[model samples]
Target chain A: MRATLALMQSRLDDSPHLLRLGRLFSETVLIEVDGAEYYLTFRDGHLAAIAEGPSRKTPWRFALRTDADALAQFWQPRPRPGFHDLFGLVKIGRGRIDGDILTLVKNLRFFKEFMALPRTAPQPEETA
Target chain B: MTFEPVTGRYLTVTVQGRRQRIYVEMAGTGTPVLCLHTAGADTRQWRHILNDAELTATHRFFAFDMPWHGKSLPPEGFQTEEYLLTTDAYIETVLAVSHALGLDRPILAGCSMGGRIALQLAALHADRFAGFIAIEASDFQPAWYDIDWFHRPDAHGGEMGAALVSANISPHAPDAERWNTLWMFMQSGPGVFRGDLSFYTRDDSLIGRLARIDTTRTPVHLLVGAYDLTCTPEDARRTAAAIPGATCTVMDELGHFPMSEHPAGFRPFFADALARMKVADHV
Candidate 1:
């Protein structure tokens, strides 16, 4: 998940569409990978907010505190084999989505596009 | 033998309210071939064949995604129409691109779903292409239609075990290389497994439709990987026998993915197909 997240960050830098968005606000995201949970954040085309501190509780921990059963429903993230279906990874009943649902729905396409970038290539050096 | 090498290009296409990412690798410069990938693999699997020293000299090849599998979109929901849309969308896209490029009916070559779509496209829209080369594509049994294959112990266990065991089998490969391949699918998690398992379980009687195809017009060739776990050589042979005037060849020392696993074996067989197509054109 970290590797893919890193690749997503790299692609966002080169994204023409995203460059137009300018800097984004910090939003906390909790992504579950394999069997582990992670707290991640995205803003300004960079992953600026990952959980720090020991006993790191995921952002989803907050979501679970609010609604435990709802969090359970989100855990069954079934990623589609098709490229279009990948966006389902972050959608409702897919990933452990929390916070502003409105923002997520509105900007889902941008986020999905970021995830779709070819991850097979090596992480290119940052260039001005 | 020398031509401009094809580079992989990534594009976004929106399907059913979802924006999907797809990669297309177009090589050579003649009749276009839409190379289809198998289950559990992306268009990357066609790298060797698309860049083949012989085939590149004669044909233009294009390979891309089939929705949620590769760089394409994941499922909105698993429905037959969605799966069918994946094929139809690709064919339409290829056709439109070909028309814009001013190209004619090119041959279709596929493995597994790639092969399944070759047969499907030929059956529904035969006029779209010149011929088909289906490798290990005709393994579906009638019983498979009734079975809940996703739940099958052998299928799931085998798929996971195959990756781990195969990686271990390769001594020369570095640990990172093995993990790279294994992690690619593993990271996708159980959702991908269930989705693909459901996808593979889908099979219908294209046998009758296949027989109705005019072999003289659209020459069909069947290639089988000798040790194919999913689609056996015998099944391929049977499929060929059923299709009027279709030819079958069993590639040695290979399994379900002969194109990737044994390109040396594929070269001559593919070369022979090109030759036969040329001979037919002249005659």
Candidate 2:
């Protein structure tokens, strides 16, 4: 799971669309996966930091919560319903989002595309 | 109502002066509904519609694969080359298939690329169809996303294409339906998706042509999924407004590939549109 977040950070850094879409917004977001928390710091349209565990000093603009299983399925090559998207997970009771609804709505496309990056990345080799 | 097995066969037809073998599937009996599959997809997209006992009993559903798509291989001479479907070729194929099958003013229904062609048919040859049903279609697709990602060499026949498609699948759809929709994308032939997009995003333009359609002769109906980013409900409404008397309906909990993504959820909307078309036909 940590590796997936690291891969996501790399993908987000390299994505021109995400950078362009998120250029106007600068905020820290909290993504909680089954009690585990990760903080994403976006600055000047790029992902500046991805730190695991909650941040006590920095105030998060938004917080999204979901089970680890749902997060895993969302990153699958082809995810099923209830896991295909963040909003979809919420719709099916697998996930939820709180705080800064406006920020989320204003940059919905960027966030949606950003989270979907793992699916487009090359899969890791399977070990025997 | 009980579901019945659909019968499938290959029909020889001359499209664009080239002899091609088109694979067609048919079920039920009554008013002929000629269904067109979305780009890179085949007749299987209409499985739910074909198997619906009520729809079948009232109307005969026919879905055909375009040349070089699904079971319909390209003509013998062009087997080795990459097949790129153009607007002209697509229109001609649909016309040729309809003529070959001797369908009398069949109701033409299509989704995505198929949906776009429905408008082209109405604009160019309105008399050939009883009614036109366009799902997730629009006059223009804004360059919002990078289409090149789907065509990247590394992504070819890999998870990238399927992943992109899965994103468009409605998150509200059932798990089985979402997986089934992704299966279609995974099974599509190489370069077929990109080739289809050439027509979808590049060559096909119906902006000026929409006004030329005679709705009195052939009623046009537009249905869009609420969740479709490519062809949003607003786009469908704009298209509907352009064509005189064209009715537009926005389907909720549906996305780009509505029929395959959530056929059961989409059935009500499909039935409503078909019913309205039938009523308009009599009026």
Candidate 3:
């Protein structure tokens, strides 16, 4: 999951359109995979930090939770229905999103494209 | 419980005073359903719907490949030209094909670009269709992504186009379905996708025009896939809200190509839309 966050960061860094989409705001998002947590801090449209195991200092504007199985399926080369997207997973009772709903909706396209990074990002073996 | 095989053939139709051959496939008997495929796609996109035993039993399905698409080759003088599908040409071809086939107020079903056309048909020629089922359709889209990569001269034969389309398919879809979609993408003729996008992303703006749709005479049922980025669920909902009594269904776990990418998963939503249409017809 930490590796996945790293991959997401690199993908966001590489996309100019994504950066522009997020340029209007800054926020901290928490992604909870099972019991483990990761904090993603965005400063002025760029990903500033990807800290693991949660943070006591900052309050997350948005938080999403799902099990390890759901997260793994989401990152698969090809996903099946319930595993294809965050909303799809939520609809099927496999995932949940809490905290600031407006923040999520305001940057819906940015977040959607951001989460889909793994699909286009180079595989670990390919990079190695 | 059993069904016969679907039959396919080519039909010559005159559209805008120009003669062209179109590939048409049909199956079953009862209320006729004239299906329109998405941009850069052909009648093959309707294979799942055509082959569905239950759907075929109650509905006679007709799917056709547009000119320069699928097995339907463009006519003479058009062989060397760059093809750009305009909204006028698309509507003309659909009307011409329906007229040539002598279809009587068939229920129109379409997806993506085809879906936009279905909405247009309901608006312009409401009396010509019993009801129109539009999947992944909306009035306006604020061009979310940059599609210049699709028009790159070096990316002919749809390599980059296929890759981009593959990304839109839901990752949860079956492996076979995913590969089948890729096959369709790879099979599209060069520049056909970009040409189709001209109408999809540019000309087909049915925003204020949606209120002209008569829901009582011609019921419009829109089904948008939850994962469809091009025509998001919110877009469909907004479109539905503008049209009086127009129904909208947002299907979970489905993407842009709902009918083809994951037909089995999309079946329930499709079935529900048809059921709603039937109820509307009786009303």
Candidate 4:
């Protein structure tokens, strides 16, 4: 999990086109897997830091929460039907997106692309 | 560069008691093939097929924009009622156009909603066309999300619609075609995409429709993209099962909008389908 997140942080910061897409976005997005949460803070499109969750102090605009099983399938080399997409998760009832939906919708493409970074990048050896 | 092979024209036809000057495009000369686009999209979805040099050499292709989409405008009294596509109306328009053109059993190549209707066409009017080619389609597609957001005031309708469709595209699709597909989807008229989905997601009894489809009369070939969650490969296979002798091909590394998102990759699959259709005719 740690290695994968690090890979995501590096890819999100280095990819020029992705950076351009998220250039206007500056917000903290919570990614909750199983019960553990991680705060991904972005400053002007750059993934500044990812905090291991202590939800009490961290403020986030929106959170994409899902189970470890779903995430595990999603990060596979080729995910199955219901686990392949972010919205696919929602439809299949394996995931829940809470908080400000407007912010999420406004940056819909960026968020979707960011979440799919693992699929695009070299898969980390660590299992989530 | 000015004179491309493809040509465009208007066909004034009456269907469902309303006259519409439908925009239609054509390219090449040979056995005629009438193509149909996906929901919320115009004929431009078939641009690649229309312009395919190899296909053009062997087959003539025609594509049209549905009324209220692209260059085709709605009827005079359109403002009085909502634009909702029904099965009967859909069949009427296709038949009207085929009759207007004086085509002799032209093959029907349709995708998505157009594809769904192809099955209906095969059942109701099999003799009119040589065969049916359905792409990324199924007997019925379950509504996966709340379609209300597609046309609501707060959301940018076009972007919202495109966003939903975009995720279904294969990750390996080329950047150019992928963005172009999304761009066209982003130009959808307000409520138009939603209206199209109403018909696409209509829960009318398809078991009877499928049972009536005689593959012997109108040969059926279905192609579904692997990444298509809207109408998964499983759906296509199930549909083929319902219609005996129908063929379903699962296109790997492609998604819902196979033609628009990965035209180059889709060509071989389409060609294979065409070949199969030819063999069926000989049989």
Candidate 5:
């Protein structure tokens, strides 16, 4: 899980378009996977830090909760129907969305594109 | 020094008793195929079909931007009432456009909201059309979230529409084509997408009417994309299963905006459907 987050951060850093979209976008998005938590903090659209959580300290604007299997399926090179997208995950009962929906809607494109980075920009086999 | 095979025009039609100017595009010259786009989008979605050498050679493609979408501006005094796409208004406009264009029993091809309408047309007015291709559609599709966000001033309707619908396109789709599909949604007029969704998502579905669909009068074909969560393949299959003799297909590597998102991948399925329609017409 930590390895994937590392790759996600690396991929996020290299995305010029995402950086452009994230301009002045500062927020903490919480991603909960199988009871484990990952707080992705973005400063001006760049991923500043990804903090792991078993404790409650970081405040998040929105939280996307899913199992590890669902997250893996979502990040696949060619994900199946009802598993290829964030909303797809939520719609199919594989994932959950909580907190401010309007915030999620506002940064929707930015969120969708950046989250998809790990898939579009593939990493070495070792990472997989 | 070249131009696209497609040409654009405008015609005035009365929708729900109000005079409305509609923008339409067309290409080719065989059997007429009336194309209908998804919600918040316009006729630009059919550009690929209109330009396809093979399709244009065998079939005439005509697509119109429903009033308030694309170059088809909303009727005068539109601001007076909240915009909503009721079943009656939608059918009225489609019939008016078909009549105005002199299309003789054209084949109806619609996607998403357009798809639901295709089902309605088959049930209520089957003899008027040759066949129905309802792509990425189902009888009942409840929106995941509130529909109000699509039109409210505080929220950015265009971006939200683009973002939400983008989920329905396949990840393998060409970047340029994908962006073009999103751009159309982004260009939609305020409340226009919401208006369409009013009928598509919030309104009563075609459940009670599906059993009444007589495919022999007008064959019904439901095609869905693998990635369209809004109206998944399961939904299309279920809808098809209910309608007697209606056929359903799940298109791999395609999504809701198949026509506009990736023409190369979309054309084969569409061409195959057209062939089936032609066969049905002869029988």
Candidate 6:
């Protein structure tokens, strides 16, 4: 799971936008179980994380882990009273609150944005 | 068991000197839910959804035509957001009708543009609602600075206004649904396009006011569709996160108009929202 988390991190860390944004939090906790893996990354604006749950297939069942309180703080519309200092406490491969469904939302209020500005159409392949 | 038949009504009211007739269909017994239509759509977008058995069993529902569309009269200066009907203006219009019909402070259930007004009303007159259900309410634009990809002048300029109607269903929806969505946009006339620029470009901080929203005791539940293109789930999450105690629920596989797109899935979420607000003093 740590390896998966690291792999995901490398990808996001490589993005220019995220890099430009700087690290919101110093460290993140990664959890994987039941074919699901979630990375709870803490950052400045709020307690932010990325979850790649059971949506992925095979060998990886759905499992999630975060700073215990981090899971409780996630679904809150606004930041909980105190979630900043707890960033470093989150660890990899520790699946606390595994069966808790509300824990997903209880930990973070995940907002998904679907709209994208139309992208340019791919040009025709150069014919040899 | 005593069953009462649902009743519907229509009346013409004058707003800013324009004779806009409001058509209303309401039934049930409890606090009312004032339904607002989205951009480029009329009241009928809510027509079928309102008739659902579960909704009727819970509370009274009132849906009306926005000015210049459906049965309402076309106002003179609606193109500009400044000139278009405002939260206060609509409240006044509804007040007159409600006063005539005897209604007040019903929970607001709005989508898209209607959602904006609901948020506005909740912020301004917090005492009015027991709770609010805003479906895909526009909380402000997302990554507005990242528009390097958009290039269609018409899409930007409202030339393809037909494509911009509110509470959107889907491109491949049945013909009748498509026509309804298209007609809603068309009914806005050229003004709808002009009005969108005003809507989409409004200051973001105005929306930030929700951060300070004291909804009296009324809690707000954000019912956002996971796949909503217009409002987007990220916007919903961000907006919900901004509010103090707002509960955010994202319906799966649903689009901008969850009520129309997936009522069966939306009912339980709606019920849960109402239940959350039903707690003491949270009204």
User: How large is the i-RMS for each model, in angstroms?
Assistant: 18.1, 12.1, 11.5, 7.9, 6.5, 20.2
Ranking by lDDT: 5, 4, 2, 3, 1, 6
List, residue by residue over B74-155, the lDDT tens digit for candidate 6: 5555454333445556656655555555666677788876776677767766665666778888677643212211223323
Leading candidate by DockQ: 5
Residue pairs in candidate 2 whose N, alpha carbon or C atoms collide under 3 angstroms: none
Candidate 1 residue lDDT tens string, B1-283: 8654777776665654555556677888676777877655567667667777678877888887655566665545554332333445545554553454345677778886578667766666667777888877783543222223222333342234234223111122233433443443433323343344344445555666777767787778887765454565777888788788888888654456555644555567777765555533432
Q: What share of the true interface contacts does each candidate keep?
A: 0.00, 0.11, 0.16, 0.16, 0.57, 0.00
Task: Flag regions of model 4 displaced more than 4 Å.
Answer: A1-28, A41-51, A54-62, A67-84, A89-103, A117-128, B77-81, B279-283
Tens digit of per-residue lDDT, candidate 2, span B83-144: 67888988999999999889998999999999999999999998889999999999877543
On lDDT, who's better, 4 or 6?
A: 4
Worst 10 residues of 4 chain B by lDDT: B274-283
Report the C-alpha lDDT of model 3 over A39-124, residue by residue, as the tens digit. 88888778799888755786899988889888777777656655766766675688888987656655665676677787743232
* Candidate achieving higher lDDT, 1 or 4: 4
Better of 1 and 3 by TM-score: 3
Q: Which parts of model 1 are misplaced by more than 4 Å?
A: A1-128, B1-4, B11-20, B75-103, B142-197, B279-283
lDDT of 4 at A112: 83
Model with the higher lDDT, candidate 5 or 6: 5
lDDT of each: 0.54, 0.80, 0.79, 0.83, 0.87, 0.53
Q: lDDT by residue for model 2 over A1-128, one digit each (tens)?
A: 67887888788888887788778768898888888888888887677888888557768999899988888788776466446677667766888889976566556667777777878543432211
lDDT of 3 by residue, B203-247 (tens): 745776789998888788999887776777888899889889898
Residue-level lDDT for B277 in candidate 1: 52
For this target, which candidate reaches the highest lDDT against the unseen true structure? 5
* Per-residue accuracy of model 4 over B158-192 as CA lDDT, tens digit each: 88788778768876567778898888778887777
Between candidates 3 and 5, the lDDT winner? 5
Candidate 5 on A1-128: residue-level lDDT in tens?
77888887888788788889878679999988999999989999888998999758778999999999987788887688778889989888999989988888888999987877777533322210
Model 2 is docked with a DockQ of: 0.09
lDDT score of residue B8 within candidate 6: 62
